[model samples]
Target: MRTDHMLSMIDDFNGAGFEQVDLMAPIQFDVSVRYLKEDPWERVRQISRRLPNSKVRALIRSRNLAAFDFLPHDVIDAWVDRLVANGVKVIGAFDGLNDIDNISRALVRAKEHGVETFGAVSFCESPVHTDELFVAKAQELIEKADVDAIMLKDAGGLLTPDRIRTLVPALKSVMGDRVLEVHTHSLTGLAPLVCLEAVELGADAIHLSVAPLSSGNGQPSTQSVVRDLRALGYVVNVDDERVDAISNRIREIAEEEGKPLGEPVEYNGLHYMHQTPGGMLSNFKSQLETAGLSDRYDELLHEVARVRKELAYPIMITPFAQFVGTQAVMNVMAGERYKVVPNEIKKYVLGYYGTLLAEIEPELREKIIANGASDIRLEPSEPAPMLPSLQERYPDEDLDTWLLRAQFAGSQVDEMKKTVAEGGNADEIPQPYFGLIKALYEKSEDGQQHLKFGDLAISLDKSK
Candidate 1:
């Protein structure tokens, strides 16, 4: 989003009576830096600066501070400190593996900075992801990190009302005095009902988004949820006029921009079969199209299910989902299973990410090990201290600059710096082509590639 548009949306959110506004992981990931091309910290600072009256919340992916791999302790501490310094009042941390240890340090760091912290219980469906397992995980988060709240994060939107009925009470039992917040996506078209059921079962809050941004893969619409809650005799104390005004403004923006508005999705049982996220599912379709294997889309989804099962049913959330989806695409495209494995998949199977919820099949594990990069170790090693080396390499750079450089390739950082220096519309406008460059760059084994989009074409030479 452009700076003006984002600020407008934040102002609307504040005026529309949302108690807390979540700036969705802008600091802990690369999208902001890749797209916005300035100091992501400054971007977060600016967003937090807008929400003076509202509690500013941000989510972290634990040890994967800015990169897809585990960052050193120095970086993690600095990451939390920077967020707090930038005016984020609430920090919620979740690990894709649901590994409490991965998030524990970050949560503790957030609390040390005098901010409220929420430990996320990442929700997913499987025989292993039982109600008792979630309760136990929540118990571990409370016992270890002592987070102020527990966020029931159904990132996959796999939760049904029946599941919530049982799961919410179990989590609340372990919650004790801590707040329980239900945060689920509307991918399954059941999140609205699930939110209502969660509140009935003692969830303290439910995360919601206003219309135009809500009801598709995002959270349930605030307008509809509030109306339903009020009808159910709940005292929903929000400024309805302000809420409607914000939604109307957003709708107008969508129409003016020719952007698709969030529409209610029908119940799709195929979602339960593969459990791929809406965003990732769309990516799968595009990837297939690019590969000239669009007809094998269903085959690719089935391969995802098979690969997930073989790998022990990882919560079908990010990092893991990307790993599974990529491997599935490979398996389907190559017409050979386990013939090609990504380094991340190899690391995941080796327990580098975290302890596995269940064991990968012995034969499949062997196949992964055999085909994976030979350089990757059988054992996951602790990340050595990085700040010392980074500081030594670039003594003049500030901590913020060092952090960005540490997470990204030096060339990528250079490009970002150049964009900032040139007064590019890194934040003023969305550059859809930039993502294509990033994708193509990653796929280029050599240092050079040429891409053409209609009449515009560019040749990239990383060797230079």
Candidate 2:
């Protein structure tokens, strides 16, 4: 989630009398973090202070610790420490490969910090991502990582009712009374049904977003989910009026910003083949449009499928999704596959980021290596030691500012500071001119008014 949207969502939910909501904190390697004008951590800290009843949850990429590559233990420790200190209450840790070793240390640290640790299984489809594999991973999270809860994360909205019917039971059997949560997207238009199946089969909590921000590229609408759950004789604690208010506020903001409103998408058959999350799909479209190749989008989607196959079906999530999508774009533009493979793709093929679920075809692997792809060894760099560099670069700033500078470019950090100075708190809602006019109308006994400001003139009729 972007920092501003997240803060606004939190405030809206809180104002609606919702006791608690778990927000997905920005991932350490989130590209959005780099573009944000203000320090995301500072925003998080402010939200933590403003909404004491809410819980903040961050999605940790296991050993990667939110970065593209595996982080050293010290780095992981520092990241978790910062999150805990900033008031994050839950850490949802998962490895793309469902590798328990990748997740254990982070989960253990979160548990040590007294934060709820949810060991997540990154949901995907392939021969390797079998039901048994997910169950085994969940068992490892419980027995090895000792996580407080288990989460099934369907990042691509790939889970269906048929699959959930068996998968949920399989997971529940092994979980043995442990809290289980389901987090899925609405990309496939199956998330609501999948969520229902999960809850029916014993999921304790289901992640959802409020309407206007939910559905299309986001989670299913909380109102829709709660309505269905209640229809099925489930007890939904949320107030309908509050949900409506939050949705109305979000709708207004979306309209003002010209952002797309979340709506139920028609089922597309190709979604099963590509499994690209809605956000990534939108990004791919925007990038393609910017390059004047918008007409070739369908071709690029086909190329993505082909690329995913060649790369041995890495889960369609960050880093991997970016790698595959970027390569696909290049292939489509260059008119030749592997005409230009990115360094990230090369590193991925060389096993620098962890083992792929399936092996890259030897012929393709050879071609990439022949095209100047060499194994890049990663050095173990401790994050704490980087503080000195940050201190030197941003002398007058606090630790939060320094941290943002360390994560992003200095220019972006400066812009964020400037934005804050300009009274642009992401949490502050803009008062619409219509609201002022309505207030004036309410105060006027005649229910009509006329006003003029220099050359500008305005009139209002409340009766109309």
Each candidate's root-mean-square deviation in Å? Answer: 8.6, 5.0
lDDT tens per residue, model 1, 1-464: 44545666666667766778887583434765676566567667888887787898988886886577888888888878878987889998998778999999999989998999999999888878899989999999999999999999998888999999899888998788999999998997999999999998999999998887998788998989999999999998788887887888777567545679998898888998899988898999999999899999999999999988888888887678889999999999888998999999999999889998999889889999999999999999999988888899989887877877778875777777787777654333334565567678878999788987664577999888
Cα lDDT, model 2, residue 233? 100
What are the lDDT scores of the predictions, listed in order?
Answer: 0.84, 0.75
Model 1, position 382: C-alpha lDDT score: 92
Which regions of candidate 1 fall more than 4 Å away from where they truly are? 26-29, 255-258, 426-464
Q: Distance (Å) between predicted and true CA of 232, model 1?
A: 0.7
Q: What is candidate 1's local distance difference test score?
A: 0.84
Taking the candidates one at a time, how many backbone clashes does each contain? Answer: 0, 1
TM-score of each: 0.89, 0.84
Q: Pick the candidate with the highest lDDT.
A: 1
Error of 1 at 35 (Å): 1.9
* TM-score of candidate 2 on Cα atoms, chains taken together: 0.84
